[model samples]
Target: MEASDARVVYVHGNGNKVREDLLKSQWDTALFGADMGAATRMAYWAPLRYPAPLSDAGEDPIDGGPGGPVGFEAPDAPAAEPPDAFIARTLAEARLDATLGGAEGLVPSAPGATGDPAEAEAALGEWLRDMTYLGDTLAEGESANTVPGSDAGLEALPLPRAARTAVFRLLVEHTFKDVHGYFFGGAGPAMREVFTRALDAVAVPDGGALVVLSHSLGTIIAYEALRERPRDVDLLVTVGSPLAITEIRDILLQPPAVPAGVAAWCNASDPRDLVALDHTLRPEYAPVELVTDHLVTNDSGNHHGIREYLSTRPVRDPVRAVFDGLASGQTQ
Candidate 1:
């Protein structure tokens, strides 16, 4: 389809705020910015809590990741020890000064930790200030950091400060796994409501196709939400997402509503991502049909971040194909 005729709605991963700037950053710096033309229209959404609720229990043991409603094989290697353990080790290795910043930042000596009460307040203040500083530093006080002059004339310009603040708080608190569930597990019910509400607010104009562009957990949310409400979506895309995870595949087909009418489903992933283990969401559940599966590999070793992939031909080619297919009416 012609780029001008397509509308893309982006649902971001867990612990996220559905804000414009972050969406632009993901597209420009990670997804569509490389050879992919910015001509395609786009928008993004996140969970209700901004940063959704979190669980530190770790990846599902069955899936070798974290626990969820899904099934999985146990992780081959012992799951890496939780960060709290590392904190314990740190406290043992390095003596913490109770009076320095007070007891807040000090690594607690054991589980269900307690700090010196006298210093707790002071330590809490210091930590809060540090967090506030980091938040402002990351975006330079903006809710999201955007790539300048990438794609112009896209609607939803000039992101709101209120939205940014809400998003900032959400992003800061995200535990990563819950972010993954935001797209899966229907994020329970409240998240689904936020998604539909946001999509409605965007209001795709008549005479143009609207595409749903999602990455990581966002892809899962898009797919499940569509299963609930399929009318507005034109195409669905998943990049560096854990939707391919075994747990999710089983849920879609097991005696429940499955994703349908997606028009075209495209999955692009880098091998380096530890979480994007698989891409096929049980081919049986697709309402439309998947086009092509691209095993694009990016240098970003970080499982969730696809910095290099977005700059390469792998991401560009498939996105361009989706655009071409939509513009030409061939994707369906």
Candidate 2:
């Protein structure tokens, strides 16, 4: 079969997103100048997380697309917190313990503690100071210096330090929430079902190439799905994935190895992308030789944006090569 006939299946990451059609179009434009017609498909699972899709006018907080950052209210009811091992581990790796602690301090003091308004005000001030220090430390890359930008690549964002910290906090919260829901909220089977259906929908004929492109939490979904039901995937591309984290790896169907159905696995990440802190999957996954990892600069303000990651050469070229018939078992 010719490479032009190859099919591409995209799996999006966490958080409520725009309508499925719009989301797919945005991704299509970023990866390919124009839609590939029936050659491409998106496994959209946002409806499972949010009751309704965000209006076209609203900005996706996670993506930071158009309209800038928007205020997001916390969930009114406490979400089920089944074993937070993944959340705890991810925060520690990101060095956000202090930032979270400061946020906790912002809450009103206990009933017995301070009746005086003056004292309460003082406590609030102290918490603010601590949070400021923590934010500065993160921005300066003192403790969580994983990315080139001291602020984990958030410094480039136009927002002030406090605002940047809040944005990062929200991002982390939403990211872990979705991940937790997928693993423990009884959403795993359903999410994987969505992926399975999409994969099966691909019209690739016998011997035709098939590529799976997944980002962030989508990477986790793709990995497990491909692992559970082996298929002939010409290439599996993952970006901003948290699969490298030990906690995440531990919970997945063990023993860790490249999905058997995948002929070649290419993982790309920006050094500043906290979600993909580990940056490389070659050493962790089994049959290490088959997994190739590349580091690219994601100019997206947050450095974790899917569009920026998709636009990078390391990512775009490989996918394009598969369609161009230039890619073999491994990406050039």
Candidate 3:
């Protein structure tokens, strides 16, 4: 896919572009003495929101043909309820304040999950299983595989793979679910409305192939988006993606968005980084092709330097594979 042909949507994680101070401070803590300018430039990309009505309850389905799936499914529709309910449950479990913290509580809405709160609640419990550090704790009671910058002696680090993946999951959840209630409350309906509007604004013209290059939490968002709208996605490349986080894989309760279409995914990670430890991006779903890329680098700049790892050989190879896969139409 030509760079211009592909509509590479860079979905940022956790904070907003307008909220630069907060974003910088959070990043500073993670990187630890790293150059702020470089990290910001490499990580910061595009904001995916656009103007739209905040609440669409009883409103006509916003056109998803252009933007994607903001209002793709009908309200009170059976298919739409599961994701919504799931999001509501997630917020409740995290004990988050949905609107204040800018967290996405649910997929469609964080409130009712179509109409089945009980089912949604159950699913939410399963999903939270992967968010905690215990998710990575082995039954055998063995120590976790170490990743660079993962020394608990310093900051009580989470299992590298689980940490990044859980962070990604929560960040994505923040985009849609309300965070305040003990178990479920205000979902980020406005943010979903914005995302739907933005995708509609930048509608992929001519059915040309589009490739999404994501890192860390961005990767999780991309995966969920694909799960919701697989028809719109062509190539998905995740670098330092924590898809393998035990809780994320175990808990999130939605089915594949694109169940039949063949979408290519390229997952790249560094063995020693700890964030992608034992799990980053391993293709488990069908009709979605996965090609693994190892961001082969030492433990020196581990977890915090995902953007830095992009220049290394392992990371580049799978990126090339994505391009190559698009060209050849087959190769893992």
Clash totals for all candidate models? 17, 0, 34
Q: Pick the candidate with the highest TM-score.
A: 2
- lDDT tens string, model 1, 1-62? 23545555556554433244544554654555432334433334443444542233333221
What lDDT score is found at residue 301 in candidate 1? 17
| lDDT digits (tens) for residues 276-305 of candidate 3 | 444433335443324333333321212224
Off by over 4 Å in 3: 1-3, 15-196, 205-207, 255-262, 287-289, 298-302, 313-332
lDDT top scorer: 2
Q: What is the lDDT for 252 in model 1? A: 51
Candidate 3, RMSD to the unseen true structure: 15.7
Two-way lDDT contest, 2 vs 3, winner: 2
Report how far off residue 242 is in candidate 2 (Å). Answer: 0.4
Error of 3 at 260 (Å): 5.2
lDDT of 2 by residue, 1-332 (tens): 23366888999987788898787877878887776667789999988889999998776656544442222211221222111322333233333333434333222323354334334334433443443333334333222222111122222112223323332443445455688788777898899899999998888866568989999999999999988998989889899887876546767965678888787787876544556645567667877766777666554534467887787766777688777763354344
TM-score of 1: 0.50
